[model samples]
Target chain A: MSAGTGDSVSLAAAGPILFDLVAVIVREQGRLSEIDGQTGDGDHGVNMGKGFRMAGERLRAQGEFTLPQGLATLGDTLLSDIGGSMGPLYGTFFTDMAEALDDTDRIDAPHFAAMLKAGLAAVQGLGDAKPGDKTLVDVLVPARDAFDAAQREGKSFADSLAVMKAAAEAGLEATRDLVAKVGRASRLGERSRGTLDAGAASCTMILSALADGLVQRLHA
Target chain B: MNRIINDPEQVADDAIRGVLLAYPDILAATDHPRVLRAAKRRGEGKVGIVTGGGSGHEPAFLGFVGAGLCDAVACGEIFASPTAKSFHEAFKAADFGAGVACLYGNYAGDNMNVKMAVKLAAKDGLEVRTVVANDDVASAPRAERDKRRGVAGEIMMWKAAGACSDEGGDLGQVIAVAQKAIDNTGSVGIGLSACTIPAAGKPNFTIAPGMMEVGIGHHGEPGIAVMPVETARGMAGLMMDRILEDQTFASGDDVAVLVSGLGATPVMELYILYSHVDAILRERGITPRHRFVGNYFTSLEMMGASVSVTRLDGELDRLLAHPAHSLGLTVLGR
Candidate 1:
């Protein structure tokens, strides 16, 4: 794909990024639990919504924030506020991403790729999950690779983000046929099949909302 | 849907407030609201004992925080693990110059949180070791015992570990005995009905009427068998069969028995089940040295019971007999 308009988004305009994520979590709260209830405790949406809402409120109180600042706040809130395996896993994911973008005011393709790679490394450091483990890593790994592939092909930043979102969605859907190898659902063994992993579903929603938010602010 | 709670989302916070008020002499709040330390301090040189889990299992994660038991506890949302920050704060609360032994169940959330907490504690120059309990026999095959989920038998691990620490054992000794306690212990549960997480507003799983789930997990996870509900006598036989198959108790062995109701189960029914369990033990020539029957650990309000048996050697017997003062289980004897 040829590079569409060579454009970038200002990190400052992404301060409200988590607000969009909170809305998505709030909207999909019941759906996420419904999916989790199939093989797990059915609180993925509740916990995610609680954390995202808390992050959004904190961002609003700050009045103005850069994208990295907002993500760091979200990460801190999840790490300290939410419990369960998801807390540390996602907490490190966002915190590491924020750290990668700490010095960047303008988020270009390479910067976004670096942020995601850092986030993935942080998550892997915290949990022993890999792709096909039916965890958030399922969505994250494929999404990150898709974003990097698009960037390498000289696609516009917005186009790369769109590719990441589509890849995440596909990865989320693929979890339904895979048995859980990690987390609470792993106890079910074969029974964990035929159900979408709660973490993967929420990860998809977060990535899609984030990509959409960044895309809206991309300026040529 | 009928629970005595203020806000579904704030159940953990509200219940903690009540716990602090109800057990003023037993627990003290830490800087982190989610962590509680023993009101009676363990002076220097004693290895601290810590344990924690989700909040719905009351008289559990927090109720066990007291002298001679857990020195500190990290409370979590219902059926969830406590935050890493909370676990780290609990480690700090229990740290008394000596190292701390964090004895908790083997669940994914608890494992991850404790791993992070240990990392955080290391940064602060604190030493924290862990012994994860995996006494539920039906969760996995014998070859995959490490994958099993911890059930009510975790209380036995804490009982032995806490007493060992109280006896001035070092951190390594405390963890060793706790690991032995869990290794010798075997437990299984039967769920008559599933419980609901207040926030979820519905049961995570279900048990059909007149049916029971054998080997059910503490969080309502499906079990190995779902058969028609049997008589208390029959249920005891089934539970003991699984427990015994996992851990061999010789004819002359002594064991400690714990029959805990899964929240909503009546105390009367637990005693009824315990009677049958005692009879089965007698038939096998296994002597029950100490028997504890109550809602020691539980789901939110699940209608079921779990039976845990810990084969006691000399060291475990002495440790089990140690004086412990906690809201959940108390032994008062020198």
Candidate 2:
């Protein structure tokens, strides 16, 4: 049931798991913010954690939010609950993903891929940013590309997830050389060139964590 | 990417409690539908002035409610505008009947939400008037500035306008004066740091160290230029230049200047910035009517600064000297 793309995971079973996954994700965001506080603003981790926490609470209160509903809720929550501008950007990603999933009970690999693509597109729409901007897209784009490539090789959903995790790890490291082109840190211009954007770093880390968490849970 | 948070939905609720616990000078209207709060009521007949927005602006909508500025402020969740019901409820709790005036930045959600609140109050026969701070010259030129987004400038607007409303001016007259103050205002900001949203737990945007986004608003929106982060003097120059370009206040013009440290910027740095900014204004021969520097407006610990200059006539200066008894604006006791 917890198989590859196109494999439908029921909301009942996946719902609780997804809710927990979000909890873990929220924790991850908090850690990221703490790290960010050292050089960047200290609120990143807390903000991300806040966004996820709100989403998790909503899920807990109302079990098994449909993919679209859950994603939209996450988006709106990020926009409203998490202060700062990033809320709308990330919130848009989830909102778009959820909108793509409208009325669907479960998502298959292709649908999931489409959803990811939509999420990426939504981020771009909101920020006018790109992968090389030393943004979260550095990891996200590569992960999605790798996942798609693995699918082309007839790999299982799990295998594609592995591919995504690998690509995201590589992307995260790759960011160490990139420069920030958006937000306040970008103002550092050249100074920001060597250091990976805390945002991109944290975003990639989350992708890496997500894949790891999912793989371990699925195997279990 | 791991940190601890209990029930996600309860974060705001819990945070509200934390604020009340930490700052007793403030009284959270946890008792009301909207999170309207203020410094303890002092029973002064000073006209009431209130300001509010989403929760992320923090000490902004709440922190500024005492001592030097406002009487009451209604809070919504982070980045989300409080609903009309919330504003109406806040007015119910905040109005002293001398008159109540609401001040906030110009954002659609806030406008829509607060507008409904005003209408509701008017229907109830409560005299209410409104003023919007459209200070982001980065978003538009002066002619169209009113249509542009309001960012951190609401602080200065409230400071001046709150004074007017706090005096015995009728609601309409007070609102007119506030609107005039807003019209005379011009502002722009630059971001040296990116702040995160607690819910997202990651950066909303990133800037490389030594980099900056000039003309940015508090929400981490893109600015006119992305340049190398420079010395504090250079940063002040950059922000001031944009504001100067965006509005017209000639040399020898008497102006009330607000040098705001968007959260995360300390007063020490703000003073350093003031030195640089003051030098620029002097060079341009602009007469300073009044000047204030502090972290009056913030975006959840984001490191940045927004400069606001409101051209003042005598009427403006006189009203500014009027009184209020908020926890923040206690000096100007009503």
Q: Report the number of the highest-TM-score candidate.
A: 1
- Give lDDT tens digits, candidate 1, residues B66-135: 7778999999999999999999999999998889999999998899999999999999999999999999
Model 2: per-residue Cα lDDT over B52-131, one tens digit each = 78676665777667644666677765555665566777676667766678888776447655765787788987776777
| TM-score of only chain B in every candidate structure | 0.99, 0.88
Per-residue lDDT of model 2, residues A112-171, tens digit only? 688789988877765646879877788879989999999899987767878888888788
lDDT per model vs. reference: 0.90, 0.68
Question: Chain A only: TM-score of every candidate?
Answer: 0.95, 0.85
lDDT score of residue B180 within candidate 1:
98
Q: Among all windows of ten consecutive residues in candidate 2 chain B, which has the lowest summed lDDT?
A: B325-334
Second chain TM-score for model 2: 0.88
Once superposed on the true structure, which residue ranges of model 1 sit more than 4 Å away at CA?
A1-5
- In model 2 chain A, where is the ten-residue run with the lowest total lDDT? A3-12
